[model samples]
Target chain A: MAAVLPPQAAPHEFLRARTRWHPLEIVFWLSTLLPFVVVPEYLQLASQIAIAALFAISLDLILGYAGIVSIGHAAYFGLGAYTAGILSKHGIGEPVVLLVLGAIVAGVVGYASSFIIARFRHLALIMITLGICLMFYEAANLAGWLTGGADGLQGIKIGPLAGTFKFDLYGKTAYSYSLIVLFLCFLLARRLTHSPFGLSLRGIRENAVRMPAIGAPSDAHIRKVYTIAAAIAGIAGAVLAQTTSTVSLEVLGFQRSADVLVMLIMGGAGKLYGGILGSIVYMVARDQFSGINPQYWYFWIGLMMVLVVMYLPNGLLGGLEKLTARWRRSPT
Target chain B: MKAFSLCLGGLLAAMFAASGALAQQAVKLGLILPYSGQFADTATQMDNAIKLYVKQHGDSAGGRKIEIIRKDSGGIAPDVAKRLAQELVVRDRVDVLTGLILTPNALAVGDVSAEAKKFTVIMNAATSIITTKSPYMARTSVTTPMLNESLGMWAAKTGVKRVFTMVSDFGPAHDAEEGFIRAFKEAGGQVVGSVRFPVANPDFAAFVQRAKDSNPDGIYAWVPGGVQPAAIGKALSERGIDTKKFRVMGQGELTSDEALQSLGENALGIITVFHYDHNLGNKLNRAFVQAYNADYKRNPDLFSIGGWDGMHLIYEVLKKTGGKTDGEAMIGAAKGMKWESPRGPMMIDPQTRDVVQDVYIRRVERVGGKLVNVDFDKVRNVKDPVKARMK
Candidate 1:
């Protein structure tokens, strides 16, 4: 079918900007370098943080940019994890191929589910997405013959990255692999957010009715973003599966989705760096606090979250950005 | 006053100097438990028991100061438990890894311990497959079938020809129920019917009613943890099915203090078979019970017994190795080792790394106006039946 241009106002300068790389992005990436120098033993934890960051960023693509609220994002994550795990166990042991396959499966699943997801808003939207995730969780549980049920899909052995650089006990390979993937995905997300499609999605997010009036296919854009986001989340799950060498039903759990949401909100949703920073802060804090006192650690985390929500509603990153902006504007 | 203060400072300095000369390497033991969720109560009990063991030994084992580090599993998520295990191994550099409540957490940590080659002693996890999963893993805990092996055979031998089974639908529950039914059937009994309910389900009236309608001579029930076991016992009593026509029997934890306290008089005369009983009439058990009660102000349950024995086993291993923390050396030293546990004589099977111990059959009866397990018979030298069946 032939496409028609809409009678709309001139695009904003922010929309016209092709690159979303801020100068601070280098500092963000550099900060990750310190873990290798200071605490090389914590590369496993760093890898986990990287994977979670990727998952949160995937959510940021749809939830932050397209204004869709999903409570079941782990559906894609678990899907990717199980797919990679099952395939690797069945002799498809190549890590790169397993990751790509995971993304493909999760993307297809997300695209199919997004049709119904895009038609609703608010509570209905949340419930439907949650229902889909719950269904997957139950399916994984009941298909004990294949998924291993509560015991988890065990004995998943992945071949080395590109047949070199094997995953080690210290998790050097896993950390590097996940960081590379996250950066690549972040770059794609950055470019997408500044592209015409990303702007239309943002416009739809701000006013879906106005978007349709301006002749933009809001539903199509939302579905496309959701599918892409699912693929990225799947890649995150692939990282987790390859790194951990096991996948369980907890990967698809409500807690996984909720934890990522908390990470994104804490980092600052809608911004690219928000997910990365939020994951680092939340995961590292958990590792440290939980180590200090396992019994009462959650209480401390809960208190910090409460204080953050109260004083910094835009999250730590967003709050810091506002503060810095204000300071710079006032010539201080 | 200045002279007295100077004397006290001299005393402190001498003590520090003396301690510095005698200081040996600290043995860092990391205990991972579900300290915040469904298994939290069990975790606390086990933690206290381990602490008691350390306190009794003056906080050192084989001349090395025993330092304990704890990590919470949150009871449900296995991946989080795995990461924590990794942290304990890589960051904390723990000499030994122990303590997890659920089977999944054990398996998750088992993978980490296997890869990292960390000495792991499972305290309370009852899954049969954990030992086989990791070379570094050895369990002081009993498997799921240990409790039911004697009870089922005895029920059939006692002329209970037809049986109904009800248990929570899960991995360990299935193991327990299968153990009972297999033994009962082997002893010439028929399982007339079976029903399963969720572990978290509080109301068991419907399931109880269904079992009653099946008209079996006895019901072989197993519900571990939570209030579900109490609810099931209450439903049975309220339905008047305990009035001679039907027999109710289960694993010992069904009539645990938490369950018995809630089930009250309704739990009276319920038969069960477990590895550990508070009223074991042994010197070690009597001392353990007295000390545990004095310290925690509560009765020691199965999980506490597991933890107490786990510490004793670790202490013995430390003695054998002269405080070396090599995983392979510890595992080798643990195999075929016997100990006079609070429960009775227990030995770690050389091949399976699972404990071979006697199972006790008990009936819940009022002792000092409180429900208590009274020992009746013992199933001696019970090994890992899962591995045994394969052989």
Candidate 2:
């Protein structure tokens, strides 16, 4: 039997030391690397997964970490994508410049919109976001000359990343670029989660009244987080537009927003790594099921969603974490 | 010196007369289509076909230059179409507008185009009601009821007595399915069951299962675009459903050689009604098929051909009217205009302003691992058919 030790048994006996690297973490890292070892086509798929994961992760930051639910997150994503497409079409093709511009545009929109959105509860916020997205969709269709209207903005020529790395169909460069961006964003989010501000956010989520009572401006913090999340989402959109070299009105559609929410919920919203894992699982399942039977694949997906909601409320990643915890606690 | 001055004056008079005889100003044409979202693929094909036609025929009508500016409606969604139409007419300041692929889009744009007194030529949309409802709106494609009625008559003649039907839950598909049901009944065929599926649904298993449970004498389906055929064909094959027991029909890019290859033998024996087929034995069609195949390395589908024909028809009208951009002159010239197209000779109805052309009933067959037209029969020249049913 292990001896019961005090919390400060040693100089390094803190929670950080106790959180040793688990086998699952090693497996997760290995699995993510697995796509790179496969063929070029698989690598392209992994790149898409990475971009999609980043988009979902941005949503997870606000929805899970900050306890804010957004139904119109695609607004920022689509806005960022279209901003890049519109700019490149009009002769601004530098990748770094476009990324910065996209983020700035999306962040400004988010900051402006958050003034109204941060005041609302879950349902009202969702509806308002949806309304804004629909408005943008209509506006895009109306401005045919600028946005390519309904046919979408096509034939977008993004010159090169930093005037060096060119995007190719094989997706080698795109994958690495997207992976790096995702990694950085993930690190920033993780750092935020562990910071004093992040703890205050958790405090706000736990009890809004108590956080303000302790002199924390919870609303301002939530709005700030929301704007940052939007900027991250915008970057993901820029990455997608750069890779695909085409932007359609569907990017701003309600379905896209819903899909991101579904991805976050399926992955384990509160966990940072869950977003990437969930996107991979969802996309792979979709590709496999659709190839097998195009008509009935949705039924299977729906069934799975129902099962997850009923049994594993915390999502796949959370469920796995729980299983691991239980295993560690039980006698071998 | 005085004689030379007279000669110069006479030459100037003649030059003025010639200039008066030939209209030489650029005519602005606005194109409104669902260019993005789910309808983006179809819109792209339509735009490509139109551009190709303009490139080959030159953008001059009569002697005047014609400029085509495109606007995207995003989809057949009504509100979006209305807003887009307003922007096209008010902002773009185009003389003539064309290209609406879905019924709702056509109707929405039609209203705005009429309100703005713009001459709108619908290239791909086929809602007959639009012409009867809005005088300013004229169509280049076949109407829903007319196409479905012909299909019903053909099915009756082919000894198909009972059928199961399904359509996507969109306005155009629903309208076409309803017309098919009504006409099939009138043509001595019984509709065993009918089902509607959501638009943009990727999976077809539940719908297919429902269809199998019905088990009618034949199946009549009206699904559009590339995805439907691929999904439907795969579902049917997995369910062990026989093609002979079904007669699928729809307006789709699925009839293309590439799409058929994807569907494989499952696409065989499927009967479809179309206005154009590359296999038709006509000089114009043969030339078009040759040129199109040479360029794209694939057979041009009906939508592409129809889009090409629409532009060609407009070009002919412009040439005939001496490059007039005025609504009255263009409309007058378009009436009863006859021209050789990829689908052979097509005549615009003087009364309804709809193109009356030959329609064909063809059965799909896999030859040398490629889907090609096997048995085709000329059904009818639904020329100037009463705009009554469209209302």
Highest lDDT: give the candidate number.
1
TM values, all candidates = 0.92, 0.54
TM-score of 2: 0.54
- Interface DockQ per candidate: 0.40, 0.02
lDDT of 1 by residue, A1-332 (tens): 00123437355544543353456777778787787778888998899999999999999999888989999999999999999999999999999999999999999999999899889887897898899999999899878778878767777888999887788666778888988898899889988887888889889889887898898998898899999999999999988999878788889999899899999998888887888889999998988887788888889889988888898898888889888779877975
Mark the 10 consecutive residues where model 2 chain B has the least summed lDDT.
B76-85
lDDT score, candidate 2, position B1 = 35
Cα lDDT, model 2, residue A164: 71
Q: What are the RMSDs of all candidates, in order?
A: 8.0, 18.3
Interface RMSD values, listed in order for every candidate:
1.7, 15.9
> B47 in model 2: Cα distance from truth in Å?
2.9
Worst-scoring 10-residue span by lDDT in model 1 chain B = B14-23
- Candidate of highest DockQ: 1
- DockQ score, prediction 2: 0.02
User: Model 2: runs farther than 4 Å from truth?
Assistant: A1-69, A73-332, B1-23, B34-38, B76-92, B199-215, B224-227, B238-240, B245-258, B383-386
